[model samples]
Target chain A: MDKKKRIVIQSIATLLQNANLKGFFTGKIYTGQSKGVCVPGLNCYSCPGAIGACPLGSLQNALSAYKFKLPYYVVGLLLFFGTLLGRLICGFLCPFGFLQDLLHRIPFPVKLKHFRLDKYLRYLKYILLVVLVIVLPICVKMTPFFCKYLCPSGTLAGILLSFRNSALFQAYGKLFTWKVIVLAVILVAGVMIARPFCKYLCPLGAIYGPLNKVSLYRMECDASKCISCGKCSAVCEMCVDPTKDANSAECIRCLQCVHECPTKALRAGIKSKPETSKPSHEGEKVPEGRMRGKD
Target chain B: MRRIGTIICFGISFLLIALGILDHQFQAVLAKAAKVCLECIGIG
Candidate 1:
């Protein structure tokens, strides 16, 4: 059921990401006012078909111009998404995350368990957020270091759009060569490790990770119904043990565990408390269903 | 306590967004978006 929902949501997100179909064919970007607002996902702002700004790109641009103005709007937008949905955006909305999911489904040899190195490397995203996205852009006079030098999403978008315009190949240089190498590494690593970018290097994920602890939408577990089967932890892609910490910063709220639980102990919702109801109330003696419904 | 914190954060974010709209900051964002971002296109 969750897989079907994921497919539907991913399809809609892909459509929204490429809503400007004409731009894809013409090799032109959407210049409408809608482009001014950032999408709540890791989409490339320069994608010819992208109709909205990328939050990471927008943040860097605002930071670059910090000497003259404050980035209240972009910051506010980021805060809104973070506080409301947290990494649910990463799980359900991000095109790059969706791409990683598709790649992992290709029947390749994948890393099933987390390693010590992986845990340590997860902190790199925060460093990337602090340095490339914020520091370098401001220091280097408005140059978006992360977009130009690092982001595989931007590189992939540039590649797709460049295919539409052969003249772009003529303008490619050393920087583009470096970006291609970076994109290649990320692509190969993505196939081996689930969400390598989100787990290790996406600055956008960095911004949303800490917010997951306090986001309104959350994962909750009913300890009373839990059978200690470790199924939820085993199914988690991000190496989070949902039983130990249902609202872990690493959890994307994908609901795979909620679907897999035998006792129906796991749930994802905006509610403050985890529901502890039995899967079937037919055996209860007090006709508790009607009484509970009143609450 | 956490719920209250979340509400406060949301309130601050909404206020800032409203202020941005009133200040016409969207124009600046539009100006940035109208031009193709060279760095993002892998040319700059």
Candidate 2:
């Protein structure tokens, strides 16, 4: 199969029937088989056959007390992957990211400007990543804040698991109300902006972002090859400055740069040279976008 | 080093996945262990 096609298919897989069945098990079932790894993606844990653990949930569980404990292996795993690939996992592996990509396929769209309310809004995720994903769990020690308060994954999982057990419905109360509100917000945002939650609130993205510059796999601009068509930036759904800082924090490492470069001057894969040097010419503007190379 | 990083990424990812599956399959056991060993394994 074609590479892009594979990615599309992978993204679509997030929507299938993946009812979680783990809650039913009351005994030990460790068979010493399976990947034994955490996927560094925002895949719904409730999805049936989900072998990977949710880092956000794990982090909250870990920081539950002042003393705190849980093998740091999961957090360590998240950092290792985030530092190595940044949001490349979102571009390549996350089922939620795939959902956003599909939503972007819709004809009606409103692109956001970087200097507006959007810039300020980006900070919300930092607040979320720090407080909800980290601080709250440290303080509360009762429930997963993001899962109970904001994650859509819980809803997706709940619909699968709770629908079967009526007692589960009775078990739901304030926690369910809180999660539904968050899901409603996420759902509404998906309809409005291309990726409102991803753009503004995912903690994992916030973690992976700073590592984009240092990551081994990255996007690069061949300044030496010539041409400054702004098409790359215009085509970017993430609103990143591809030519100026192709692998900057804002970039999700999606292949839009590779797809939109008319000059074939831009490439995505790895860093070619040290990027500390400033561009010799800064004001030159290229055509808004170069279309046609998604696959 | 790059190869090591790549191998580690693959290894660690699978490890977490395996652990999650174990927790799922043995939810009761892990939950019980979590009670006795909340801070024991460094998972608060």
Candidate 3:
């Protein structure tokens, strides 16, 4: 892992959201004009120093107001982001993803990879996206179901807000208690399981997953160069077998596989031609002149 | 066929987003942005 680059990017993202340290100490969210514009990552809108809105929160609020209006801005922003980079946002930009990456770095056994159930559990995020983020808000009429009942990001923001005003902590009821417990479990499990929330629960990741197949940015393996060494797969934290399926929904586009490939077989970029599948036999030479460069 | 389908989807999404911008939905977002979202802060 390029720990330095990851840390630098994470620091930049954290600073971008929490630029107003005074707001953090004052227990006041940045109720500025920029807050209307949603940031591409999973930072909470209610965070005391956050300067941007969360897409999930914006989506729900817009849906809740569906009786009177359309959530055009929120929907448009999400589509623009999804079509552009998909889960690449999760890999490079999300504060929650950075937190999970940091937590997983704390030297531990890292046990969840071996569980067969983990594969199936990855589908759960889609269900959460459909049910909690979409259906519940429309059905319940004005309830931000995902943010109210499930968002650990919001829960973390609540904790941050509580640091400045003890009344926020005192006001915690059953619902708040439930969210805190959920956040605690997710934080603890992050130490053992790589991106537990991202794999199993994040609606934002679920929304971006399908976009992976169609986004302009694509990852490819050069079959002619690949030696079938399994180095790319071994280094991938997202469990993507880049050789077999470089554009899999599970791929966060973290580029670890691309960086780790000793054979220089992997590449990610905008291009004109479709990617070729990895060869079935390792020794067979790939046909020439099929792959095209950028248009 | 799949590629064509994807292109069609993108076309529709871009159109809807254009319509959204024309409708000026950003005003609604700005209105919400002015106030602190109490529920999001975990305070009743």
Maximum-lDDT candidate: 1
Tens digit per residue, CA lDDT, model 2, A1-295: 2347646655544433222235334211122222234467775444443444556665665566345654355666676787577778767667777766666556566544454788788778888988888877877875557655677765655554455555555666665666667777776567557677788888888888775655657666766443677888887778887777766777877777677777666776644443333333344433322211110
Instruction: Show where candidate 1 strays beyond 4 Å.
Output: A110-112, A274-295
What CAPRI grade goes to candidate 1? medium
Question: What value of lDDT does candidate 3 attain over all alpha carbons?
Answer: 0.79
Worst ten-residue run, lDDT, model 3 chain A? A286-295
Query: Residue A115 CA error for candidate 2 (Å)?
Result: 7.9
CAPRI verdict (incorrect, acceptable, medium, high) for model 3: acceptable
lDDT of 2 by residue, B1-44 (tens): 44355556656656764664454523422332222121211122
Q: What TM-score does chain B alone reach in each candidate, compared with the true chain B?
A: 0.77, 0.52, 0.64
Runs of candidate 2 with Cα error greater than 4 angstroms are A1-9, A12-36, A65-67, A107-115, A271-295, B1-44
lDDT of 3 by residue, A24-124 (tens): 78987787778878888898878887888888988888777746566777777887787777788888889999999989989886456658888899999
Please give the DockQ score of every candidate, comma-separated.
0.56, 0.09, 0.47
TM-score for predicted model 1 compared with the true structure:
0.91
Q: Once model 2 is optimally superposed onto the true structure by TM-score, how far is the C-alpha of residue A263 displaced, in angstroms? A: 1.4
